[model samples]
Target chain A: MTRILMKGNEAIAEAAIRAGAIYYFAYPITPQNEVGEYMARRLPEVGGVFVQAESEVAVGNMLFGAVASGKRVFTSSSSPGISLMQEAISYMAGARLPVVLINIMRGGPGLGGILPSQADYFQSTKGGGHGDYRVLVLAPSTLQEAVDLTMLAFHLADKYCNPTMVLADGMIGQMMEPVEFPENYVEEPVPPKDWATTGCQGRAPIIIKSLALDPVVLEKNNLVLAEKYKLMKRDEIRFEAYKINPKNRILVVSYGTMARICQTVIDELEQENISVGLLRPITLFPFPAKEILAEAIKPNIESVLTVEMSMGQMVEDVEWAVKDKKPVEFYGRTGGIVPTPEEVKDYIMKILAKETPAVKSWNG
Target chain B: MLTSFPSFDKRVIIFAGAYGSGKTEVAVNYAIGLATSQSQSVSIIDLDIVNPYFRSREAAFELEAQGVHVIMPHNEMCHADLPIILPEIRGEIERSDGKVIVDVGGDDVGARVLSSMVDAFAPKGYEFLIVLNARRPFTSDVAGSLKMMRDIEISSRLKFTGIVSNTHLIGETTTETVTEGYELAVEVGRAAEIPVAFVSVVTEVAQQLDPNVVKVPVFALSRQMLKPWEEKVKAVRGL
Candidate 1:
């Protein structure tokens, strides 16, 4: 296969098209508008459809309608824009529609800066819109991984019949990298969905919806959704462990762009005879809680440190996974500022020097 | 000895190309080179309204420290992604100062910002160059590169007099990669009826590049527009 140099946004859009996603509906948003621009130009060549919706609110419903017809559909947007689509996301989840969503996250709360950030961790891993529904979230650290996960998200959504999201920061969306797609690669054949509201031409009418007016039916529907999430947790968890061993004293848990920096930090520390292990979670929703716990409870491990581009969002999950056996600490930079490798190494040095609170607890 | 770029007689230099074609990096290097090479005033105007990251203005501290005046938006609006074109840009272009380097945004959408300053450039006799990177998807071949050149020309309302062969895979660049881009650039320049101005190779690869095949001047580039993690990453990966 011929390798082509592409930006992350364009790569993800192409991967979706190659994965049999023929319909894209989205409004323009930065750090990710390249996906819409590329789609507008390339989709028509493949007999696909691209629509610039009036707003993100409208885009979400458009995806809902398109995916309900049993055709693959996806959309890409940034932070504030993603918030506008949450209502539709929740509705899609409750109705058990298989749709793919990409969140090229920027800084938070309201219309924040257009720099890379991971503040949407809570919104992505947990329920963002409403209720007890979950969106299966995949986070990739490199452009190659971003392309692979984008294609995989479609299959996972169809398999589990739920909404699947690719959570990437703005840096990944903007940076240029060389990547290759399999030539003449065919997608895995998915069974025809009998539940689609296609039409009642000859057989009975099929109703695909979220409205369960009866309490018993609502309870059953919620349980069915809960079972799908449990299956994802059991089967779809993905993570990468680097330099993990019994001699390591500090275990760093990070994901996405932050994890790439931590890998450099770990390599630098190794040259100085300081062994630091890194746990990079590729799946945010089906988080590698068990894997993290196993690494944290090692006899030589001193403390568990979680790093992020936000002010300590995923650290909660790390703390929960460690179960307080090891002192879980957090270091972060928020509001569009990415934490550098030097900063992360210096924080690790402070932990090693017994200057931070983690050492005080260890001594006690 | 390796050949270096001849000093420019034109006061205004503008760089425009497809997105991710190394325009900002080339513009930054050119501004710093002009300031240090000769005892003269130099200014770099960042007119990128398309991308929010990796703009020439991001290297303001380094560029200013090197004695080059950096023109961008003021304090609160500095990092804002909204398109805020500074009014002083036209004044700076019209001043007939020592040297002015304009780093335009990528593609036709970004080149559209240049159309607004057509009158300012008409009086000053500018040297407009298209930075071509064969590694970028849109301009990997001769036809794709020519289409982008025409699109940018039509959008900016300024004809390009030169073509800059700047192709590399960031830290993974090699001498072969530079030569490949130089060959493609020669093809593009021939078809467009423009001169292949020079080939930009990173300092490391430039040292290893054979000077016989490349007849044009060679610009040895030192990466200035690095992300926060790039410093340590280069060290760790030995790039």
Candidate 2:
């Protein structure tokens, strides 16, 4: 396979095409506008659908309808736009329509600046919309990983009968890197579309809806979804542990682009004779709690710092895994501010100094 | 194969092509090359409004520090979604004591912006060079190259005076890869009835290639669009 330079947004868009996505409906928003733009130009060439819908609200519904019709469909948007699509995303989840969504997250509670951020971590993992549902969230730290995870998003969405979010940030979207695409991407052997609305040809018509009038029936539906969630936690949890040594005292936990920054910090700290390991979660939904617990309980591990581009969302999950056994410190820069490796290194030094006051002299 | 570019007779030169065709890289190199090697004062404008990643304006400060004039969007307009061609464009077009190279946006949509400025450049006899990088999906074949050239001309309301074969696979570009692109570019030039202008490669890549094989004018490049993450990624992956 030949590797080529690609930006994260356009690479994911092309990956969606290679993954058998037949339709793309999106409202362009930074820093993910390239995804929609590239899809608009490339989709037609591949006999796929690309619609620059009037609004994200409209495109979200379009995705629900297209995926409900048993066709592979996906959309890309930033934070504000994803917030607008939550209603339809919830609908797609309730209907069990397999659809892929890319969130190249930027700063915000509202119209935030168009820069890299992981503020949408909770929005992606904690269920953005009002419903008893979950979206499979895959966070990619590299452009190649972006392509791989994006392709897997479709397969996983279909396998689980739910939506999968390829969560990224503006830095991931705008940064250029070399990526080799899968050559033998067989789009076949897809999930069975047994519940599609392809006309009532041979049997009783089926209805897809999120509403349940009967409390007893709704409780049963919730239980079934909860079991699936448990299955995901058991079988589909994905993470990567870097340089994990039993003698490592500080474990730096991070995801997305921030984790890449954390990897550099680990190297810098290592040179300073500090044993720090990097625990990066690939699948944000399953939370990699098991991996976190195992690594955190190792001897000589005194602290775990959760680094993020948001105001510390993933730290809560790290805390859940730690269960107060070890102190899990949170370091974050919000509103699209990507903390530099130097800044992260400084933060790590501060954490170390607090642990043992003499450690501050190691900075030189 | 012309080993040397024709003298800077034309007041304005425009570079246009597919988004990843190395237009910005070429324009920056061309401007710097002229400023250092020639007697002409050079000003390069970044009018690219299509893709935002690899714009010439990103290197404006570097170019200006070296006595080359760089005119690009200012203030918050740097990140603006819509295209905003500065009004100074007319003045720059009118008062041409030296050379001005306009790095246009990619595709017909971007060329449409250039169409509006053709009248100003027409009197000065501007040269529009359609850069072709065979690596890009849109210009990977002879047919694709011709189709894009025709579409670009139609939208820009100008004829392409020459073609620039700037094929590169980022850091993986080899001599044979460039020679293949040069061959493809020769066919494209024949079909378009235009001269195959100088081919471009980074200086290091040029060293490995026997110049006799390419037989084309070469512009050795300096990689300018290094993003924040690329250096570390290259070190880690060793690409």
Comparing chain B with the reference, what is the TM-score for each candidate? 0.95, 0.92
Cα-based lDDT at residue B186, candidate 2? 92
By summed lDDT, the worst window of 10 consecutive residues in model 2 chain A runs over A355-364
lDDT of 2 by residue, B1-239 (tens): 22444344788999998766788888888888878878878899888887645578777766887778988777767655568889988788889688898999888888889888877999988889999988766688999999999999999999999988888887789887789889999999898899887788888887676667776678778887655433342221100
The CA lDDT at B214 in model 2 is 73
Q: Could you tell me the interface RMSD of model 1?
A: 5.1
Model 1: per-residue Cα lDDT over A1-364, one tens digit each: 6566788999999999888889999999888999999999889989999999999999999999999999999999999999999999999999999999999999887998788899999999898998889999999998989999999999999998999999999989988888888677666776569888788899998877788899999999999999999999999999999899999999999999999889889999999999999999999999899999999999999999899988788888888899989988788887788888998998999988877763222212
Residue B188 lDDT in model 2?
A: 93
The lDDT values for all models are 0.89, 0.83
Tens-place lDDT per residue, model 1, B1-239, is 27485466888999999998999999999999988999879999999999888888888887999999999989867777778899899989998467999999999999999998999998888889999999888899999999999999999999999999998888778788889999999999999999988888788887787878787889988898875667653221100
* Residue A277, candidate 1: C-alpha displacement in angstroms: 0.7
For each candidate, the DockQ is 0.43, 0.22
User: What pairs collide in candidate 2?
Assistant: none
